[model samples]
Target: MAAQQPSEKILVVDAQADSAKLIVLQLQEAGFAAVWARDGEAAIGMLDGDDYSLALLDIRLPKANGIEVLSHIRESGKDTAAIMMTAHGNENLAVECMKAGCVDYLSKPFAMDDMLQRVMRAMTNRRVLLQKQRLEQEKDDFVSMLSHDMKNPLTAVIGSIDIIREGRLGTVNQEQAEYLHAAIDSCNEVIAMIDNLLDIHRFEAGRMQMKIAAYSAVEILRGGTRRFTRIAEHDGIRLRERLSHETPRIAVDKNAFSRVIANLLANSVKFTPEGGEIVVSCRCLKGAEVPWTRLPSYVTVPDGFAEKDCFVQVSIRDTGSGIPPDDLGRIFERYVQSRSGVGRERGGAGLGLAFCKMAVESCGGIIWVESEAGLGSIFVILLPCYLNGTECTGK
Candidate 1:
């Protein structure tokens, strides 16, 4: 640990010259690269100038004060850790600093050895946090690239299969048509899985790019159902659409939006038994009409969505074995596995919903679910309606 400390630079912010110098020297001697700042303001400047592993801050300072400085770090969302030190050490103030995201707190005139241990702990914490973030980023990148690469060839194969099925190459018999349909279905299932993984990774990493364009909500919904029609029928299930007479255009990434629709429909088709019915419906929703209270926390609706005037709401209601009541709240979370029929037994426990939630939120939309144990489920989405690249206000 001592040998590794040289890589971690620490900031010591104390008004008292003697105390600050002593602390900096101790850290330097212990193999860390320590810098001294005479006040909170100077600490802030140092923070901005270079990457610091941790900050040893004094609660009382000439400018800005320790709490204010820490607040700045947090508000800036920098990857820096802080440990508050104060001459007037009170239990309440320590608790307050801790709550303010300090790694540790120390009183003036404290033992030098004790302070070093605290510094080491804070450094360790920072190291762990940074390592975790790096691992998560790597995982996300791996999945994103994997899925993107797999999708292209799979798509080409599907297109070629479609051409053959349509007799573009030659005449096709009924049996051959059945075989081609099976092949298409298998390829589509793979595609949907790949899309789910890719989108979920991109969304989680905040790297998802959307090419927002307006399209008829009804048409988008209908197009989503086309691929699933044969699969549902083959499973003895009915797949249909229920679009309103007055459907509005929705601004979204057409491909991602269609993928969202496909994900929900696929889920419905997977669990819904033979003879079950799946209805894809589209309607308009006022911003105030969204049941915000019932919308689960797992759905990541972006800021200001609640204030939109008009939205295009699409709901995929299925007569499948409904989600377990306890799982509804977490169904949209990544990797969530419900205990009921929607559990890991059938695969894709929580990934599809995560992708759906993120996709909707990317368009400044909201997505949620409603269901009981045996009453089937309805996955509802509300994407803000836009006219010419701007959100539509209710007329």
Candidate 2:
């Protein structure tokens, strides 16, 4: 079999047959795989059916307007770079096209050189963006996997401290108990941080692997709730766990997966004031979709995937002094502690949600949150079922 050569694919749309044909010749002459569409509707149909590296759009088309096509492209969540062509009087329309997410604009009656330049620029930008995304993804995956591996040791260390506290090793004096308590507290803090790092790293990496076994979601929820009972009581906060159904034995990694749920729960408890309420719940996610609209050009999602397949969704909601709207996107970023002066005072490194993201992603899932400052916050995680090994298409 002959090796298939990789080729740059460009889509050309123009109502004017001559202009479109000219551009197509240039692209083909330059060794690109080009598809020509006569109008906006045809362009959109082609885009929906095939992957194109760049789209050359004429602002005026017969069936659908260029701006309308651009809007549809933005809405469909495929970020194909669009270069709009406008006649002289349509400069303002070109600006409008740019606002509609056109990568570059070309005035009509332009030289072929100018057209080639713009197309080349758009293609170059797309490649650069894709490369940057891959690099960041790789870094996140490495860190997340490392964090998961480190957890066993952290768990053992914490477990040993508990044994000593119970006098399993030997009896100790009051002064020793106090010192041990302080040491254990410090260790717990570090462990929490490590957990956060692991979660964030995995989430950012976008490589979630699940080790599915039959287990009750309700049991996991209750276990997580019970684990935090003492702290909730101490803090005077009301914590509730609700199960919409007797959750079936679903496939999951109890320890790694529960940690994500626990992290959200812990954050709620930490951020919520005394007398505030924290609710942890498990329910089916119906009609849930990601805002892939803003994704830049050059990203491609594989088949057998839907935004929903990202995970079995879990949500942790809290009635704490909530996060500001502006900070919602950045909150999951490492060290972006929204609490800032207050959060620092409360002692947070801002890795909790980031970690949640990583852990969820490692299990082939996603994590996101909804919150308004002074209102409250709801952190949601989605993990895929059937905890199989990662399928590495490697883009």
Candidate 3:
């Protein structure tokens, strides 16, 4: 099969009128839209007036050197790729041109075929870069729109719930009260999901602020667990916790960290079969070396390696239908869903893991999972230990 040829726009800048005209004629003959710039100054003027996909520059020019013109193009941040032309006697000039930001260098004595090849390669690179930038901008726009659209309705629903709960309308009967409570709970869940979206925006914007303070492992777990204990009971799932008494006071953003643990616990209960077990465990580890702490082989550490440090490792291991191996990598991406197996068994927007990931990373910690199909999944979090911080003995 014959391949389709791509049409390109080319800009030619040269001091030699004959050389520039000849190249432009060749490019046009090859079906390129060729724009001519008589000198470096003229090239900059042309760029200011019009957009071109690629620019072919001559190293020797009036008013500005090709390198200077290339530097200007780069500084302008245009996606216009550049090919610098150098006379055969100025081979070193070609290398210098490349260093100055020309995408390709063509020696003056080069064949028309070689010139075309370099121009095509440069244009291809420019096109790819521009496309990537456009896609990223679209992604950012979508996230922003999603955040606003989703949060507004969720805020309204929560506000309505508050009004209903406060008896602003009227007194409620037992059945109405039950239904209102359920409505409030549902509203809270949606609010949490919307908060997840806000968390993503904050994390991406590098705006996640953590308030570091001393907190007790058992106490935080107890309060967080109590909040969700009713939900676990309503679903007939067992929420068990085993905390080490020796678990030291850790430096953490208490409220945010509590959300991390509570989200995981809630997910465990939601996914587990009615009678399944969800175990929450916290222990202080001494000399625990996690993956991120390890230096690559080529890196050598100077002396005074601190050891015997403390880290509070918390795990929410659920005996639920586990995550499939294929869906593991993408589980943390925003709005990404696991399509196969158990993910289909349980319907969700797949935002929980993404939320969990953002929350964990925001608190200067890490969260990951260990799971196998049909076995279970265990989500683990590790936080740095705090020494002699005020304990939350929970009044």
lDDT of each: 0.84, 0.72, 0.75
lDDT string for model 2 (1-395, tens) is 12112467889999989889989988887767887999888998998998788888888888898888888888988868889998999998898778779989999899998898778888889889889989987876677665666766766887887788778899977777766765665566678787666545544556445575656667888888998876676678898877766333345577877786777777787788888888888764432454445322322333344533333457788888888767777876678777523234567777876666555555445567777788788886644433244422223
lDDT value, candidate 3, whole model: 0.75
Worst 10 residues of 3 by lDDT: 296-305
Candidate 3 TM-score, true structure as reference: 0.74
Give per-residue CA lDDT, model 3, range 1-395, as digits (tens): 12224445678998788878889887887778897888889888887777778889888889987888888888988777888888888978788778777778888777888787777667668778889999978877877776788767777887887787778898877777667777777767776776777676777778777787788877888887888777777777888889888888777778777877777886787668888888889997654454445322322222322232567788889888888887666777788765545435544666777877776665556667777878888887776666687422222
- State in Å the error of residue 141, model 2: 16
Q: Lowest-lDDT window of 10 residues in candidate 2?
A: 294-303
**Which portions of model 1 show Cα errors greater than 4 Å?**
1-110, 156-173, 285-311, 342-346, 383-395
Model 3, position 79, has a per-residue lDDT of 71
Best by lDDT: 1
Q: Compared with the true structure, what per-residue lDDT tens digits does model 1 show for residues 122-171?
A: 88788889999999888877786766678888999999999999999999
Query: What TM-score, over all chains together, does every model reach?
Result: 0.71, 0.49, 0.74
Better of 2 and 3 by lDDT: 3
Badly placed stretches (over 4 Å) of model 3 are 1-9, 29-33, 38-42, 60-63, 88-102, 117-121, 124-128, 187-191, 194-223, 240-259, 288-308, 323-346, 358-364, 371-376, 388-395
Colliding residue pairs in candidate 3: none
Clashes of each: 0, 17, 0
